[model samples]
Target chain A: MTSSHLVYLIALPLFSSAFLILMGRKADKWGHIFATLISAAVFGVGVSEFMAMHSRAGDMRAVTQHLFSWISVGTFQVDASLLLDQLSICFVLLISGVGTLIHIYSIAYMSHDKDRRRFFAYLNFFIAAMLLLVLGDSYLNLYVGWEGVGLASYLLIGFWNQKPTYATAAKKAFVANRVGDVGLSLAIMIAFAQFGSVTFDGVKAGVHGASPAALTALGAMLLLAAAGKSAQFPLQSWLGDAMAGPTPVSALIHAATMVTAGVYLITRSNFIFDGSSTARLLVVIVGGITLLFGALIGTAKDDIKKALAASTMSQIGYMILASGLGPVGYAIAIMHLLTHGFFKAGMFLGAGSVMHGMDDEVNMRRYGAIGKVMPITFATFGLGYLAIIGVPPFAGFYSKDKIIEIAFNAGGTKGIILGGATLLGAAITAFYMTRLMVMTFAGSKRWDDKAHPHESPVLMWLPMVVLAIGSVATGFLFNSGNSLVNWLAPVLNPNNVESGSELMKPIVVSSLALLAVILGVALAVTKYRTVPVEAPEDVSIFTKVARRDLLQDAFNETVLMRPGQILTAGLVKTDYFAIDGLVRLIGAVVSGTSTFLRRIQNGYVRSYALIMVIGALALIATIWVVTL
Target chain B: MDISNYLYLSAILFTIGAIGVVVRRNAIVVFMCVELMLNAANLAFVTFSRINGNLDGQVASFFTMVVAACEVVVGLAIIVTMYRSRRSASVDDASLLKR
Candidate 1:
């Protein structure tokens, strides 16, 4: 079905963003409210479209809207179009829905900020871009949205660019994302070369005729693009530093919507991954390595937001790993992504609320016993904590456990290794999250006497309450009746697992995950039951390394950044000496010749006449010699 | 007398006039040397007319004399203006165009 309403999903927020920014300080008082309403309106459109899709059946559920013919050449053609299928509807709702709530939350959160109007502008811009990312019909169309979000992310991350470090963090993110964009560009070129098309449907149809090598190359490049945007390993270093942005930016762009773009990309390219096991295995390996890599870093982080950043990385790793599992893993990865979006966004907002009450202090050690002072934040954050730890009746229990079960059921030594790694990740996630909760909420008060913690205003906690409710309900809602999977089946083309091919039963896997969670919580509770206000200077080497984000930045500097710096320096020297020097030499020769010839033009009339006579005589002499 | 002797006399007069123009510093002396060169050229034109048996060279000589009379008038006026402005008539003294 063709629906004209799809364009409004992106247009409203985009126009509002422009209006808010152009209006400047004059709209400061009501700009955030306007932005929030626009976001809510976009959500309203998304929900209405989703309902329209839901009322239909099977393949009829998806809708496309062609705005115009965007690119047309002799044989190449592309349309500026939108697709509101089951997959994209989920993202659209999450981006605009969570986005609206964040906008509301930011209304109160940034009331004191003089640049509140600009903040709303960036938020609206991001919502529009993220919507475009999901709703784009083809890889080329999606790349436009991809770059749009990267630009918005850079802008929002450096929203307070007066701080040099914050500016650096933003540059780091932009540069890293550019590296990944190169991968996306390469993937599109490969798609066009291999299939003569860049659209999802076209690529899917062409995958059968293409060679495995082509498919593998396309999949790997897509994974690189995903890793960069999704903050997967290697390219993952920028995300932690990205905490330098405001909390809402961290929650919205870093934690919830933007970071999951990788999982979305991989899932959208299911046919390519399904075509090549080598590409699929590489995905699993990156996902597995990052899951543990992030989880280990999470264990030692003292900053509340950085800890959440690490956890966000680890959770995205789960989604990436799930997407790698082929037909069985695709829909489950998205489900996990949706649920993680809610819980993680809620927790980040909760952290922001804590910061709001505590004078922007982020160290968890100074946050002991403040839960008593801030009840609503504590309750909302506690629910998110429960959801993330995969406790029963909460969101993560449903989504993350499914990923673990599927990892175990891949049915080989590979399955066992992946399964075990995910299990260990779950345990580590529980430990760190519990430690964060305990360090901030459960222990004796550690804040100084002057600090009087209080609950955030109603506007802030209202969104937290909404997301907390999502955290508690979305998992069960998505899991019951296998609804989410069935809804996405048409898009993902899920393959049914034969009965008894499973390595472990669902109940056994759930029980094992619960056991790991229990062990992790127990260890955290005992260790942090009585915490010191100051983090100990002397600690294990592992603790030290984890505290330093496992030296990912240092690793990047050595492997990528340092070498890049050297190459740049060499190029600069080459430009200065070779290119500039050549031009300078030419300039010097012309000026030297002019200077020597200029002296002959001394303004004496007698000398001028003497030269004219000599020249005339010389010319006559030459004519005479020629005649002879 | 051979018309070639008249050509030789014209060439010698032109060379001496050119030398005078180059060597003289006074503006009046330079102007007089320029007039002498013009007359020497007119003599050449008349000698060539006689030898070639055509009226073209003689007509050209008549035009040259007219042009020379105009040049003398303009040149004397410019030298008088320079002398009045600077209280000197040396061509070197009027070297304001020197680099």
Candidate 2:
């Protein structure tokens, strides 16, 4: 296929977004269908592009579509271009394919809303932006897509803007992302200064010759950017609150597509990370800490979406940690990323289905024995849960377990620490996820009288079922022949590292992971299966802190927010009392002088003539004095 | 016959016209005094032309005369309109600009 066809992948959604927005409420009747069709067409184009690239031999698998000269200065140039390579192709398929499903899901999820058309428009906009992000040839172009998705996410998260808290949540997400964006912007600037190019290929080729310190700086800054987008540690406070958005938004932007941009970025820039051990270790550290942090918070969240949101953060943390493990970890990170997309989106959609049946109620404590009422949701959510906890034969097992095995093989004290952390993360993941499942589906009925639980429409359950199947089978398929790893070999593992290294036997790792899962499940089932419906008012300090997201809010307040508030207040005072007062003083001086000067006019021709004569005399006297 | 004498006579007439413009209350009288200043400037221009042995100053005086005639037309029209409105010709009485 010609590289020009790549435009269709980006243009389809962009055009649909423009169409939906321009048509406004007039297209409400058919907007969702139009958006879904456009997304499906984009997915078809993505599949065809993948096939075309696959048919090509070796390096030719990567194609660049040069649109125009974007920027040009002496010895510096960037093109408006798109690259259809093995790595980007994966993202394109994931975004468009999964995006189409979410679009279909949103149709049913948002059907009752008055502004559903606008929501669909924003979804299309998001897909277009995400497509731009993965497909862009340069860092600058990618940034365009990056900010585009940010705006789209901001719009989607506040889709129900009538709620003040929802709007605030949207603002919070946007602001947190902006913090990371600054890091990305600086990274690009430093990259240009160091290598004189911001193109992915240019940087990858040039990065090896660069100073290790520079490479480490680049990698660290990139990690910060990833942390913001993927909701990693320190920047994670926004993800749980982002649950205030519509469920489809949580499923698509938060769980599936947008959040994975960070993983894609680190994986795309693998060359830089490969060169700098310090940078790689930093990536691992961020990932490791965030995984534990998110999982701990997940264990305490009562809101179903927020629980899933925390789970999403922890899962992304795993992917980030994996990406930090060097070449072997990059491929595995992407593998986990793809599988996580399927299962997380499925699980979030399942959460939406429950809320739909339970009169939009979100508290998991209020949900019980829902499995009997909505078997499809329970079954899909159960598959996703099993996948997430790394149960054998499920998608997460192949991807996540590989990461753990690789972490163990990383060697010495660091390896053991990383491995142990990942294992602990896994057990905690299984525990919290199991608690969520039991509290939501398996226990005695705790639903209020008003909620009449029922199966969602076929439209909603259909996507969940598809994603659930993906959650079950994708891991085995991808890991079995090393097909995914091989397909991605040209871009990700150019040296073709043999994919068989385990510090411990494969059976041992799998057994250990399975043991953790079983123990977690057993612990949760015993504790929560017969527990009271309402959350107990009194809890341990740890639980309280975890419930408050490990005091992240208070920390943010003390560290970032409070100082910002005080600084703003100080500036406001200075503006009012000092700067503004000075301005007022100048105004008073001018007015007072003008009032005094007004007497000189006196409204008489004789006075004006006399003043002009006196001014002329003064000028003449000055000139005469100077001449003398 | 000496050019300096004409320059001195022009300067004295210009000063007298300036004082008349400043002291006079009647708009017609002030207008006449402004014309006198223009004539005085014309005299000085002619004297400078003779002293410098050039026709440039004489040419400038002609241009000034044309401009002064245009200014008279515009100024008299404004004065006539103001007089018609307020029924007064004294320069002090036409001080509608006083705040």
True contacts kept of each: 0.93, 0.89
Total clashing residue pairs per candidate? 1, 0
lDDT of 1 by residue, A1-628 (tens): 8999999999999999999999988998899999999999999998999888989988798899999999999789999999989999999999999999999999999999999999999999999999999999999999999999999999999999999999999999999999899999999999999999999999999998889999999999999999999999878999998999899999999999999999999999998998999999999999999999999999999999999999999999999999998898999999999999999999999999999999999999898998899999999999999999999989999999999999998878988999999999999999999999999988899998888899999999999999999999999999999999989998886465432278988999999999999999999999998988889989999999999999998898899878999999999999999999999999999999999999889888888899999999899999999999
Clash pairs of candidate 1?
Answer: A603-B98
Best by lDDT: 1
Lowest lDDT sum, 10 consecutive residues, model 2 chain A, at A494-503
Query: How much is B4 displaced in model 2, in angstroms?
Result: 27
Tens-place lDDT per residue, model 2, A101-120, is: 99999999999999999999
- Angstrom error at residue B39, model 1: 6.1
Instruction: Report model 1's TM-score to 2 decimal places.
Output: 0.90
**What DockQ values do the models have?**
0.65, 0.58
TM-score of each: 0.90, 0.84
Residue A355 of model 2, lDDT score: 98
